[model samples]
Target: MEQDPITLIISLAGGILSFLLLMRFALQLSQADYYNPISQSVVRLTQPIVGPLQRVLRPKGRFDFATLIVALAVKAIAILVLIKMSPMFASAGGSISPLHLLIFSLAGTLNTLLTIYFWATLGAVIISWIAPDSYHPAPQLLLQLSEPLFALARKVIPPIGGLDLSPILIFLLIQIVQGYLSALVVI
Candidate 1:
């Protein structure tokens, strides 16, 4: 079914905004320094949402998973709302059940998050290779963000001949998960 322009625009906007918000939250949760322009921008954009949640959740020490929860919740709500209202704004033909919409939004969110991670990792690898001694904030942030993912991947698939195949494996896994979730939404 073809989506209406208005609905398509709204959905796209919501998806992008939510992706940015979630990435900012993830960076903060990972304790990435706010010294770079990108980091500063993320902080400024996310403070309105994170500030209040931090006050309420008050994570005891270095671990603050609440921010992740809040970000995900906000993203999910925004996506769901956009999907729910899409028919009103756009001339879509297919009947989107609540369950289908929910599944689609959730899967889309996850897909976006993983894509962000992939990009960040790519950036870090590039920066590290080009200027090993460069004091760039993005590389550091990327390193911090990709560590856990890389670690998990390494555990499952060890490096071969000094080349890390973990990322490729993980990417394939993410693609499978995305495909499965997308199928749920359509079926």
Candidate 2:
């Protein structure tokens, strides 16, 4: 069945906001400097939502995965609520099972997270390529953000010719996973 336009729009907005919040939290947790005006503005805008989460889900050791978890939770909840309310507010011509809704929400969150990872990784690679000598903040931030994903990718696909093919492989893997998860929900 075709999705309601209003519901689809709301769901997309919620997913995007949640993803930005999560990415900002991740960037901060990585201790990347928000030196640029744009970066600082993002931090300021998202701080209200993320500050409480950071307090509640305080880091234990060196890493802080709480932001990521909280962000995913927020997106999942928002998507679930939108799905549940869609039937009441508008008709989509077909019924969506609760399990399907849950899976779809999960797939949405995963897709957002994977997209952020891909962009951040790509940004890092680009910065490294362009400014090998310059002391830029974006490159450093990107490297820090991409490290975890690249680490995981390295185990499965090693680098070739001093260039890391892990991010590309990881992006493909994420897309495949998202497709599989989406099929479980809506196909």
Best model per TM-score? 1
The lDDT for every candidate, in the order shown, is 0.68, 0.69
Cα shift from native, residue 150, model 2 (Å): 2.9
lDDT of 2 by residue, 40-74 (tens): 87678777776787788886654456666666667
Give, for candidate 2, the lowest lDDT window spanning 10 residues.
178-187
**TM, every model:** 0.72, 0.68
lDDT for position 172 in model 2 = 85
Q: 70-139 in candidate 1: lDDT tens per residue? A: 6556556666656556555456643466665566556666667767777876776677578756666766
Show the lowest summed lDDT stretch of 10 residues, model 1.
178-187
- lDDT against true structure, model 1: 0.68
User: In lDDT terms, which candidate is top?
Assistant: 2
True-structure RMSD for candidate 1:
4.1
